[model samples]
Target: MGRTSKIVTGGLLVCALVAISIPVGKEVVPGLFPQDQSSTVTTPAAQLPPAALSQVASVSELSPDAPLPDAAALSDQLKEALKYDGAGTVSVYVSDVLTGEELFSADGWTARTPASNQKLLTAGAALATLGPQTRFTTRAVTGSQPNQIVLQAGGDVMLGRDDSKPNEIMGHAGIATLAKKTAESLAGAPGPYTLAIDDTMFTGSTLNPYWPTEDVAAGEIAPIYPMALFGARYVAGELTGPRPHDAPVEVAEAFAVALERAGVETIGIITRSKTPEGATELGSVQSATVDEQTQYMMQWSDNYVAEVLGRMVARKLGEPVTNEGAVYAVRKSVRNLGLPMDTIWTVDNSGLSVSNRVSPAQLVQYLNILLKNPASSAGQELKGLPIAGLTGSLSDRYIEPPSWEAAGVVRAKTGTLNLVTALSGYVVNSDGRLLSFAMIGNGLTDGPAPLRTVFDNAATVLAKS
Candidate 1:
């Protein structure tokens, strides 16, 4: 039997492991054992303290000598677990993180609608192109005309209406703070200034024509904008409902109101114009870091954030910054990572477009890349994936029996549409091997709960292996 060794680092662990062929077993490994610890050592679960009993194993505890899951047996188990009772077809791909070996694959090469899973690709591209430390700046500057103030839209769409909160992802920068700063800058200089907005950071259609208008009206998504208050929501903390069609104007109006409270009177009408060359800077605030924003995008599956990130990617790559540009930029960036972009099709950064097609294999391969060098900029993508039965979209899932066994061990990104569902991310298996998997279901006639169960059960099987 061949032996392999690898060092896993970044976001999770910095450890080395040596693999050898051995029979798979059911014993759980302590994720944080000392390096000199014996791989065969075991502590009965019943003998452990309650706190230790409740703790799930972390990746650091994995031993390279740990037996890999029997591929053939694992395939049999997954095939059975993946069986769906409804109409749709499911494609699955699972691989070992250490050796990049395919453990199980079922129709993995065939592309299917990825739904929100498309955001994974967008997240990768944005992280790679714009970098994890990058931040978008919204600035208030003197307009080309007298008594004119221009509000320039950076790439932040999650602006708060009140003071900026330094520790938050949403509203890291606030409109009211910007207004106060702008008011101070104009002290003893002017009154009743004309307010205007500059949103040229993005160009072309604000709304993706490929997305259904009904979905837009229902607030599944709104027209993409450079800046928005509470992520275009009418109320902060509300994830869904009617959203402003023109977010830039809305943010500017809020700024106007804030400016009035800051002792700077603003004209009632908010106009649209570009900041003049060499305009005097009045005030500016930055969005959260790209890493933080990406985490938020993944955790909540925010369509607006994903789309804006896509546009930002386009701008970085010198693309047109339109829907077409964003899609092109994402595909190109992912391809640059050496993944087979030819195998998948994407229409939008957010998987809201039903036309988007991605194979389970492609998704798994991407996860593998992230796992290989967890410290790289691309590795930051892993941090954004939602932990099962805990944070993000997976919070309510994997909490029930049969699936609960995998909770806290599986981290994944989820996608859901009326006819499509997808779950892709990495998991640390019972044998202590890190594994990446992707499951996508399409053409579904059944309700999503059943299909989600099927997917979760499959992931749970991986965790147990």
Candidate 2:
């Protein structure tokens, strides 16, 4: 081509670049580009070349201006951002906390495994349906005789190690309370009486159906029998071992011994029993409110607690106590709030099974429902979540500056089991707007490494501009 034509083309190209500059900074594109010949970006104080090597200063006193991409504009584009890493599909949803604005989403409605994050749903379901003042009821019933009583399972997950005064037994002292109650009830029977328990809160499915049968028996995943009569041994923040097989029996023995120490003579055998018809109520204990329950469940990323909470959903909704029943019931609970919830598939309420899937969009919907319906039992439950960086799984997050309020200011639930890592929570952004977000990753080959920078960048963006 002719030199004159080349010069003319170059000038037009520069003009076109200037026009592009008007909207350049909308969304942060990739790295940097040259702003002028022989120099990068020029500023008021410094005169330099296209770039430098030492500290890599921006030469421009203006701190260098590439272009400003609208955060609100980029918000919608943030969904599936982790997809760039070529890992499993990642979905994100962020909303304005105050204005109810759905800032962004990518396949947000597409269901995906939520991992431990599912505990949030269980916790939320429990808190919303049940009141903060609500407590689980653990009761003692008499089936045959006064001295011969039945220690019935009443779905008390926090039942502790005592056996006296079943109604007000300290959670840790529950087993002992049971023992005490046994002694009091036997009150000098003619023959040696026995203590049998009825764990029928969940009848159809006794174990975590989603867990491998071998693993279900005693590992981190035990059969979620409706009898948390004894506290599950939570280790490394996960259920590592099952309570002894003779757990309840041991509790009965303690009660009997305590009574004998109190001068009551009795010989009895404590064992598991069937839930019989027309069982009578002898004494009982109450569970904490739904809010308190959620707090406990989420802070520790508990699975058994989630399972029990699922059972509670079944009980309250009058559904069957199977995995399917609980999922349907929870879905119904969400729908009852008048939100769209067709995109979720809850295989297990605890999210332990890879079969479980939830869309980032759906979580945001859940959050919106809660924010809009403050009087709602569910919203109240959401508030029970531990403060980020302060409680629950998020206590250690966002330890650095320039990071979003992912730690203390955010109240979110984290889900991680094996190769998956997830985060879902609420944050009040700098603009004083409430933002609900979900960051979920699956098939993380290097575990969660591929998604760390993505999460940090997103959080930084949300917190900054």
Candidate 3:
């Protein structure tokens, strides 16, 4: 058989084997080992919290038609693989998607800093609240003055500066196109007109106080604005750098330049104002669908995109478009999912804020919901996840043992910071049964390298189980 065939055949064989022997209530799954012998393994050091144990118990009574690997053996392996005697605490949660049973858990309810793993929640929240087909629009409307024009930001944070290059999202809808359309609409009635920018879609501070001072200065994050060119940076043509503090004003200036080149003249200083209610729209550019943008955010762990989507969610939910508003919106979205909101405490949509906290169990539960209905909006967001050793953030991972076996089998989200490391996603086990799992580490004095190894090895075990 070819490599693909072999893999498929092996997967089917394991599924068939497991499907044939159902275990009695609370009894060990039959056929894991000989009927007469038993195996022992280490238990996780951290005790499962009451909340997590309750969730586990909810699935304990499930009686699958097929047998599964010995829960004790899996638990032992996970315990051994996840044990890290470093400064930080570690949490692990794993569940069998087919049987709805908790296979292993340790401190699963303990909240920890998630790093980029927070994007998973943000992505889900956006899909749940904004719908899959939602798109942002940037518009040019008539200003209060006859010769003046208002460039209204419609939450297209990634809008391109010009029309030279095309992009799937913002770049496709170029500023130059809008400028040409605006000039045409004026019909030579304008020359050296003053321009203004409307950025009131978001109502609060651009910079989050919780964000580190150095990150803003170093360009790790730009001022979150609704209408900006190239994600708020000067990426016209080939140039890209940190965006100015007054990004919206700068974008208005650039739009003025584009208007002039398109036969419209602009004069005087550009200013900020709210677009009049009855203003006429000269031109508009739209972004890609929310689903595609979410995929991009998840694949690259883009902070700017995440923040933009968060604000979008806030707007959809009738909340202010600020850091606090984003948190409230996400909370509303999660609450609407019928999941408890106590597990999540977020200061900002992008996990860049160290103040964010989320539990391992919460992450796994969210994944389980998505897995239960892969066709649902929540499930569609999973398309953005990086595949182990194949694409996205995981492209460089799983190339070596003991993670090699999971190279193509594991699809997950990775999170890392100074001392935090997290991994959450799905794995098709050796039995071809899908599983949802999450692991997180905090206060890791040893850094993330060793914890990453532990997490990868744990994933490999699940894939090969």
Rank ordering of all candidates by lDDT, starting from the highest: 1, 3, 2
- Top model by TM-score, which number? 1
Candidate number achieving the greatest lDDT relative to the actual structure = 1
lDDT of 2 by residue, 162-244 (tens): 43333332253355555455446545655455566677677676565676555456454555655454345532233466554
What value does the lDDT take at residue 30 in candidate 2?
Answer: 9
Sorted on TM-score, best first, the list reads 1, 3, 2
Q: Candidate 3: what lDDT?
A: 0.73
Task: TM-score for candidate 1, please give it.
Answer: 0.88
Q: 206, model 2: CA deviation in Å?
A: 1.6
In the range 349-394, model 3's lDDT, one tens digit per residue, is 8788888998888888888777666556766676677766655677
> What TM-score should be assigned to candidate 3?
0.82
In model 3, which runs have C-alpha deviations exceeding 4 angstroms?
1-67, 164-167, 236-241
